[model samples]
Target: MSCSEDPTCQELLDHIYELVDADEDAIDERSRALLAAHAAVCPSCRDAVDAERHVRELLRRCCGESVHAPAALRVRVVSMTTRVRRTE
Candidate 1:
């Protein structure tokens, strides 16, 4: 189902990415149901789910530790946040 047709579908799509590393058999019924339903009706979501899984697997293989933001990127983000907060 298109996200516009069912808002829950988009939430389900998002949840699919979150659940990728979780134990499939241990996943809650609600998530499993959403995944099953979405995969059945939405090729785009299915592809998204597959792509996310592949990326996660690749990351796991290439980087055992979680990725960290570069110091420069972190400083830039902090500066941007500070400016935004000041403006607000």
Candidate 2:
């Protein structure tokens, strides 16, 4: 049932959002380990993780209720979401 044991489980796990909430070490040791193992062999999953990180950073930097990202970055994040959803 662990994500690392099954590609399908890994993919499903990657689609979840909480992976981004965890600290880097925790993410790597836990969440990202599954996705990282899969990503090592799968370019698409690598791209998804990269994109998710970028979007999360952008949100933290600019998209909070108290702050806003540049219009262009906002648009890019929104567009990335569309692409992410398609891949999922």
Question: Which model scores highest in lDDT?
Answer: 1
In the range 3-88, model 2's lDDT, one tens digit per residue, is 45545534645544545555452234454566556766677666776787898787777757577568999689868976876796
Candidate 2: where are CA atoms >4 Å away?
9-16, 23-32, 64-88
Which lDDT tens digits does candidate 1 get at residues 1-88?
1122242556665556445655454356566665656666788877777888798788888987677779999789868855774695
The C-alpha lDDT values of all candidates are 0.64, 0.60
Which stretches of model 1 miss by more than 4 angstroms? 1-8, 23-27, 65-88
lDDT of 1: 0.64
Q: Tell me the number of clashing residue pairs for each predicted model.
A: 0, 0
